[model samples]
Target: MNLVLRASILLLVLAGAPATAFAQDASDPIGNILDQVGQPAPATPTPPLPVPAPRAPPPAVARPTPAPPVAAPYPYGPRPQIAAPYAPSSSTYAPPPPNLSPSLAEPVFVDEYDRTPDRPMNSAEQGYENRMRSSFAAAQGMQGPLDGAWTLRSDAGQAVYTLLLVDKNNGRLEGAWRDPRRPGSRDSSGFLAAIQKIGTQLTASFYPSPGAGAVTLTLTPLGNGEWTGELTEGGARLGVVMSRN
Candidate 1:
């Protein structure tokens, strides 16, 4: 009988417990255990991640170097040298020879009468011989009164000129007219031409110089070694008188 009574008490005590205790045991048993032991609950452990393989480094690159630059040449070249001039020697100089002709070396003298004696005389020699003959004839009184030097005077009695009358061997006549008073006078000689005598009336042409025209004179004999004449030149006439000089 006592055992039956204890079983009945046990059934009654279970029925008296709360419904939340059963829920706690089913949802969190450790928490219920920790509640009974009066301690906190422990956290759960996390899992480790797997590691990846490392990649290779990128490839290295290479670069080339450039060549050195070239140099240039000059624009012009060097200049040339000059040469000197040439000169002659003293041995090449020489002088000319001396002159040897006879005319140059010695002088020649010729006589005035050395030419042919038989040849006809020139006018100069004939004139000189005529003067000599006239002088000789006057000394012998063989010539007329007109055959000598005469002094000619103008109308005013001033002596103007001198006149000479000569007779040649050929019966021709020649004369000279001289102006003695002129300064620097050189042998004022002239020649008579075309003389004509008609009974002491004489007419002749006189030339004062070579290549000059003739002057005409007409004369009449006056006694005692005198004569009167008219001298004409270029159609101009003048009375003149003459006397023996």
Candidate 2:
């Protein structure tokens, strides 16, 4: 009688249980039939979610820079001065023609004094030549800061000389040269010359001209691009100043 009463009470308890508790679980096959056998079902552990590995960041793309505009160009200020890349000691030469002598090929441009064997330079004659030379020198205006007068002290005053440089090509120095010597002589056309720069200093020997003899000049460079020195001819040295043209 007691077993019959116990079984009846258990059947009433199960009948009163909620419907959601009796529901089937797909992941665990045994859970669906657990209540039929009357044993409490263990809680179905939720399978750990597969966390996706973080995706690698995309690589950055590179773009090319645009070229500058063609219609207009950028402007810089006033014209700049350019100095020669070479040192003053360099020189150039062309071999004299086999058939022609140096004098014939490279004749002295002109001689101011029409001196003959009988005719010679007197005090009056020198004064006139000096005046003409001074005038000739004054004709050319200073082309640049380097261009200036070459002055030597004389009894009368200062004797002026001009070495008017025009152009240079094929390593040759081209210009007009004048001193207390020659006829302000140029080698060829009014634009051509033969004043070779031997080493740093240029004596009258390098210059092709007619004079009393080789005119020796002991020139020292001044701080301001001008040269201060002495001109030694016939045993006397006179203060001289030379500059570039």
Q: Which candidate is the best by TM-score?
A: 1
What lDDT tens digits, residue by residue, belong to model 2 across residues 18-125? Answer: 553544354556765664587766899999999999999999989889987555333454455578796544356444345442233333333323323223455777
Candidate 1: which stretches are off by over 4 Å? 1-138, 167-172, 210-212
Off by over 4 Å in 2: 1-157, 166-171, 179-200, 206-211, 243-245
Model 1 lDDT per residue over 196-245, tens place = 67777878787665666777888898877688998886678889898876
In order, the Cα lDDT scores of the candidates are: 0.67, 0.52
Taking all chains together, each candidate's TM-score versus the true structure is 0.39, 0.27
